[model samples]
Target: MKTRILSLILLTVFASAAPAQKNEQNRPPIIDAHVHAFEKDERWTHKVANPLTGQPMTATTEQSHMQATLAEMKKYNVVKAVISNDYQAVLRWKAASPDHIIASYGFYDPSSQDLAFLRREHAAGRLMALGEIGAQYEGIAPNDPKMEPYFALAEELDIPVGIHIGLSKPGIAYDDAPKYRAALSNPLLLEEVLIRHPKIRIYVMHAGWPMLDQMVGLMWAHPQVYVDTGVIDWAVPRKEFHVYLRRLVEAGFGERIMFGSDQMVWPETIGMAVEGIESAAFLTEQQKRDILYNNAVRFFRLDKK
Candidate 1:
């Protein structure tokens, strides 16, 4: 009897909250600015063996991952998602859902991607952006010479770019990626990249978490630089994430903030990320709208299309 009573109360709260959250759907279109559509079975091998340790990572099947991600996308009224994965999978996802998926180039290194292939795809409109460029996970700084050419190419093609920066999981260095360094997580290092590639439309993925001051300082110094709240939105403590987000918005970087789920193997994380922004009491309704959709629309030039 007590269990039944509790279930009723819980259902009531969920039912009541459903309508309130629908207001989010009533707003502008949502764009998930970060995603990786790697086939689940091959996800672990996508990055290849860890050089230092010659070890492998775990996996997620492609079909299952896609089905779940798409369902969640629908559930939340996401009109578009910027997806990054291995070349074949990325192409297939875009080809399969061209209208809903914005194909992006991603990997730990630019060298892993063929420049000619990327150029051809970008020319043909199959690849819309270059990103989740992630060499930062390998202890690389964005300003390194290795990344400048791609930055130039992105500017030349007028394609937006996204790069990983700051606050990866603790002890990530001991995992599959031995090069991971928490010290390299600073967004200030991106200043040189921004200065050199003034025309490139780039967003710092993960919003450079735990580097709030550096993130804010970088955005302040380089107004064109944008950010996406990805893994941190769902992985971090709700209150902690809110505090970081609130600080960014309070510091006057709201317009540049966008949504990204970084939904790898777990598609359920998409809703969690959305809720992170939506449930923030510190954020107003309009602010939520901006973070969920409007800012991304502007950042990705969706309005023009």
Candidate 2:
């Protein structure tokens, strides 16, 4: 009887000491629709704090950043990523991880020479998409005439485009981007552009956060438009992010929403971003799968590849 009691106590202790297991191993494969790559630069040496959490991310060298990002992707079963950066930096990442990387050209304002370069690169199959086109940082609206040619080019190529349309870093307008305006983040600004270029496959980056009504209206009006939950997936408070996402899903737009990390400097944010969607109780198993992988597959036409 004493021996049986001791065994029972040992069993309880062992069970209590064991680490809780997550079903992540059984989780469906993911495709992060937004990611960024960069060359070795002094800027990477500085730790940046997460605006919502006040937690400073670890500083990383270019090599470490690439290694950690890839490791995180593997850990989370991320099968593919749409990566944007300077031409050469993106090329390097693609060369290193050809199977996982979808190369995109990220630009603010493209010079005539830059446009020519993009044309040549796309023809040569070096670039697949155009954007994080961040003209908003320059206070340029999506309907600005200056953006027309870029949209035209995207339409002509039949490749996807991801545009920055929503909130930037807190206080970014005060310093980093003096021209930045919150008003330009409105999804409604894209209406004219969308109407003019009906064939362009474009997705709003950050899902046009905090502009729920405008975003919903835009998507309802323009069925071709899609969105990526980039920085907001992990950068915003979880409760707020979930509420916004739930609204989009409930509004019958779940099929167009895709997962993105917008993982600029912090590699671990990739996993955090995935967890953000996984933690949403309102989403069904199929809805979560669609957001994580299927939606992007359909949007990007990956099945054709």
Candidate 3:
């Protein structure tokens, strides 16, 4: 009689807890994989001075932009955002929102100076990943010896590398200005580095831009390769961008695709993209979960806690 009663009690408790557990499991957490933030600075601007064009960037305040971002995240229930920025701003966001921000370092190019700093930061646990690094339209290469140290350290530490491919700012000098072209945007160029250091988690940002289809192929070929949908959605026409992303999902690359607003433009833009992904007909509920949270959680090892 005592054993029967104990068993009955446990069953009763589990039966009552089932719905709550299901509800918890059903609620998907939102994560913005591509994000940029800045500190309180007087001279910050989202507009980049086209080095190639020699045009100046119109300065804008980051205060309103950041506030709007936080509000949007709250609206969409975004649990966290993987944030990157120039050295100063990254540190500021980390300090301000340590709980919600996963900080990363940026490499302008394959410069020894930048590589040394990132390598040291990576070893010290100051940055979670290495990225927005790669050959720009200007025809720079990342595997140069200067970038080798950073790559090696990242490989050793087991952090993902994010590369800003496809689209980039023009050159400062007109003669040497980087041109946007298919040759410069090829994902195959990364094959050498990927084959050389297979352990490194490399993410092709902007879904490799106008080369999304090509990038999908690259991700298929390389188990360790991944891509983040950054400003592409907002930057491109909605109808066409939707079709492009749909093809990515149809190709079964949804899990490998990460969600990011490329928040350089604005914080609200981040919320809109998250909503777009959530409502996407191509992605099932569980698939949405993977894209928004699980993928990042696994890619970045956020659950190490």
Best by lDDT: 2
The 10 consecutive residues of candidate 3 with the worst lDDT sum are 1-10
Can you write out model 3's per-residue Cα lDDT over 1-305, one digit (the tens) per residue? 00001111111111111112222233456777777765533223223332222233232455554555665666666678777766567766667667777778765556534655766776677788776664463356544455567677778888878877765433322333333244657777677788788898878787877776677778788977777877765655566667878888788777887887776634556655775676677668888777777777778878622
Error of model 3, residue 260, in angstroms:
1.0
State the local distance difference test value for candidate 1: 0.76
Candidate 1 runs further than 4 Å off: 1-28, 40-60
lDDT measured at residue 289 in model 2 versus the true structure, 0 to 100: 91
How displaced is residue 102 in candidate 2, in Å? 0.4
User: Which residue pairs show collisions in model 2?
Assistant: none
Better-scoring candidate (TM-score), 1 or 3: 1
- Candidate 3: where is the Cα deviation over 4 Å? 1-27, 39-59, 62-64, 142-146, 168-182
Where is model 1 poorest over a 10-residue stretch in terms of lDDT?
A: 1-10
Which residue pairs in candidate 3 collide?
51-171, 51-172, 52-171
- Per-residue lDDT tens digits of candidate 1, residues 27-133? 45678998878754333334332221232322235664576577678777888999986657877777777788988888786555578888998888788999878
> Per-candidate RMSD vs. true structure?
9.2, 10.9, 15.6
Error of 3 at 98 (Å): 0.5
Better of 1 and 2 by lDDT: 2
